[model samples]
Target: MKDLFCLIMAGGSGTRFWPWSRTVKPKQFFKIFNDESLIQSTISRFSTFISTENIYIVSNKSQSAVLEGQTSMLYRENLIYEPVGKNTLPCIGLAAMFAELENPEGIMVVSPSDHHIHNEKLFSETIHAAIIIALENEGIVTIGITPNSPATGYGYIQTAEDITGRNSIKQFKIKQFVENPTKSQQPVTLKREDFIGTAVYLFLKYRYFLNQ
Candidate 1:
């Protein structure tokens, strides 16, 4: 994992999970399942595979203390804060930029810092599978979870019907990115429309490496 870096994006105000999840204490720092926070669990899950030095926390200045307190294992230097929220793409771009500086042709595992996984074994295997795909190709490899029910809070990914891959991971060609649907649009049927769902794991292989 020399050129592979795990970039954890944790910079939301938790507006969606309001009241309980306030500005000072966002959902990322909340211990919903157990003693550890969501961000902590997210970092810990990848600790076994990715090195601490290569793991980065892209958060906001407001939640710096919370991030630091919750993630004791991560180094202070690895935390990158933003003055204002410019959304996910920019944050990912920032991490990619840093990764490029160190290693021009590198693979960055960009994921959310707030989410839960039922099976660690499967999750780890999926990530490694995505890593393998990323290292061997130029395209993006995303781990899209099939939603159990209608969810308006999370983003979704829609892939082509002709999914093909040797591994358990079925590689699908992403179609289009759709916006969050309202309550009226419940049970919205998706046909590679990239509907919003429970969660999505994005594995990006920077443009620098695409030429190869």
Candidate 2:
């Protein structure tokens, strides 16, 4: 088995969920739906597949202390504190660098800490399959979540003809990257807008090599 490394992006302030999600405590730290916070839930879901030591939480410096107290399984060093938030690209780049340093052949899974997965088993199985595809193909692989609805709040990935299989890492030509709709309209209704980019990605071994 390849050495698996998980990077949980927990840097967002979650302005949409504001009032409750202040700068001091972002949405990831809030247990809005269940017993555990979003970050905790994300990490717990991956624990079944990867060891605690191999998991990493990349976030801004402000939330480091709070995050440290919340989860005992995560160590201080494992929590990477970035000076400032430069969005997903930079975050992924830093993670790739760390993954390369830790293990050149490591399979790194990068995902947001705030999102929830209804089907835990299926999600895990899919992620594992993606890692395999990434290692074999030696290219950047992103997992496009099976769209439950036409969600306007999230970006859509128009899959290319080459894509196949339920858990396969298929090539998806980056189509229109749409923003959250202004209001709940017709087909763009809140519920119908289900196909949102989960920001979940699997960086292949060679991709990791190049980034580092």
> Per-prediction TM-score, please?
0.88, 0.80
Give the Cα error of residue 152 in candidate 2, in Å: 4.7
lDDT of 2 by residue, 99-180 (tens): 6777777877788888877777777777877776777775677776655455556655444446555654444544444445
Off-target runs (Cα >4 Å) in candidate 1 are 190-198, 207-212
Give residue 99's lDDT in candidate 1 (0 to 100).
70
199, model 1: CA deviation in Å?
2.7
lDDT of 1 by residue, 1-212 (tens): 77778889999888867888977678988899999889989988888878887898888898877788887798887898877879887787877777777778778888888888898888888888888887877777777776667666665665566465777765667675545666566566342344435255667676543334
Model 2 clashing residue pairs (backbone) = 149-194, 150-192, 150-193, 150-194, 151-193, 151-194, 151-195
Using TM-score, give the best candidate's number: 1
